[model samples]
Target: MPTEETQTRTGEAPRRPRIRLDQPLTPRRKLIPDYDPEAFGRMSERIARFLGTGRFIVWMTVIIIAWVAWNVAAPDALRFDTYPFIFLTLMLSLQASYAAPLILLAQNRQDDRDRVNLEQDRKQNERSIADTEYLSREVAALRIGLGEVATRDWIRSELQDLLKELEEQQRSVAKGEVFPGDGDRGRDVDDR
Candidate 1:
């Protein structure tokens, strides 16, 4: 018998599977290494907090004043960024640029945390409301069920009614209107 592969291919060699050469085989590496996003966010928050403090402002002012004094008083050869203080201005601007984004990032993270906390609080409030309503319903059901049950006052009233009827029956028997051994025959004899 002919081989199965030769029979199907009519003596032609088996075809190789097609490959997609246009696409990359492996993922490309990033220029910078990956870092923990949460850590970065926390760092940005700390930086933003420090930037907002009065201490930071005081230190920055002192440094700028010292820089200006040095540049103005120092000899020409030693001076850097003289009269206009262009370098100092540029450094402040750069710090401000970086500060703005870090502060905004921290605020966004805080907002996200607040949103999650609010959602959790809302769910807890809903659960509390549901529990309160369930308890209220249970209490109402118990009240209604207890209304149908006999209580001490109700038992006392029923016993008092039975005692009054027995007293009336005893009075009739003492007047000879009824006898213990007979039913209506005693009343009939009395009538006769």
Candidate 2:
């Protein structure tokens, strides 16, 4: 018995004795590089590092150092976040609170970008699938045309005539009977 592969362009399967499954044996998700949750998750460390710049570290260090220096050097009146280090402790606590959330926010933005990239990739894959289907249909049409041609003799005669014409053209070129862009003679033969 013939298989579906040998079927007509009309989408009918070849005559067979047995029933076939409607579903494909293996269906794959056309995973175009879309926003992968795992890929976005892995970028957390890098985004955190980028957002926690050298300037941020330097300013935080300076604030702590200056606070310490003022408390130690001042004669009680110059003390604001002073001696038993209440102000310093408060500032450090505040920094810690804000820093974690900022890093997380940066990661969230990166995740959004990854999601967009994935969506674009999926669209491209869909377009590719559409193009593939179109070409497949065209190929099926050509196959049907070849199948319907009733006379082998007519096809053979046509091919032989085409080949003879090509041979004559080649022989003319070899004998220098043709020249580059000599439009008149080429047009004359083409008309024939």
Candidate 3:
């Protein structure tokens, strides 16, 4: 049954529940306004760059000269700042204060980029070293394998030794004598 608290003046039923359990609660309003940090950082860097340029110095000099000249030469009614020029000093101080922080912010961002690049370079060097070690190991394995394999020179030397032994046996048979074994041949050579 519907109560007076649940029903609208003319509504049959509410389209949605009074409270939602699945969704997150709405955040309370804050005094500070929302802003993108990256956008602010980029804008500060641009300001810092402009302030660092010689063109900005030249323009600032021209403006100061113009301000002093106008205040000194112009009639009393037209002059804004007098001989003291307190307003000009305040403006310069204000600009310097803002510029110092902006320049520092730009430097911080550049340092972050440098750190990331250095880390990436270190990882690349490590990978290269690992790859080099792997190649060296593979080359060593191949060298060890090749050491056991018979070469053409070794095979030729062995065949020549066998041929000389066969020729010696043939010579012995032509003389109607038996050929000596390798041990007896060595003894016979020593005796001769």
Candidate 4:
């Protein structure tokens, strides 16, 4: 047995006492009997499912009709429930009492599953949006880079301009006019 007093070390202020993490927890006897909750939940779901089926409704209707017919037509000694049908009403009420909870339990389980699925879908949509945004940004960057690069049509136009400049310089030299920027090409051509 350990005392409930707070443990303190030197130079530390007293804090609220808590259970020791290093020690094993003591087993407690519960007031209610312990059972597997998961198993019970599954059983309740099964019952709820059965109750919702058309076959269950048909069977219940047939049984009730038979019960009514038997009590109405059968002799007094054989009939268990008479004119008021109190026993049938009690049985139906009992069944409703149990069925309501089981149906609610099944609905709760379905709600939990739906909530988890919705969360996963939301996360998936978020990731998809992020991926799409990232891809779009990458595409935009590539388009910008491609715009900066010289295309074949631009290169062709630039080469045509250079050719026209060279033709004009040749004509000027042929007419014996000295073009200032012709440099070594003019001298080399004259020597040739």
Q: Quick one: best lDDT, which candidate? A: 4
| Candidate 3 TM-score, true structure as reference | 0.74
TM-score of each: 0.78, 0.44, 0.74, 0.73
For model 3, give the 10-residue run with minimal summed lDDT. 182-191
lDDT of each: 0.88, 0.75, 0.87, 0.89
Each prediction's total of clashing residue pairs, residues at least 3 apart in sequence or on different chains, is: 0, 2, 0, 0
Candidates ranked, most accurate by TM-score first = 1, 3, 4, 2
- Candidate with better lDDT, 1 vs 2: 1
Residue pairs in collision within model 1: none
Per-residue lDDT of 1-192 in model 3, one digit per residue for the tens? 676666776576655647878899999999999999999999998998998899999999999999999999999999999999999899999988989999999999989999999999999999999999999999999999999999999999999999997887777656646535643343343344
Q: Which ranges in model 4 have alpha carbons more than 4 Å from their true place?
A: 1-26, 174-176, 179-192
Indicate which candidate wins on TM-score: 1
Report how far off residue 91 is in candidate 2 (Å).
1.1
Candidate 1 Cα outliers beyond 4 Å, as residue runs: 1-28, 181-192
Q: Report the error of model 2 at residue 122, Å.
A: 1.4
lDDT of 1 by residue, 73-99 (tens): 999999989889999999999998999
Clashing pairs in 3: none
* TM-score of model 2 vs. true structure: 0.44
In terms of lDDT, the poorest run of 10 residues in model 1 is 180-189
Weakest 10 consecutive residues, lDDT, candidate 2? Answer: 183-192
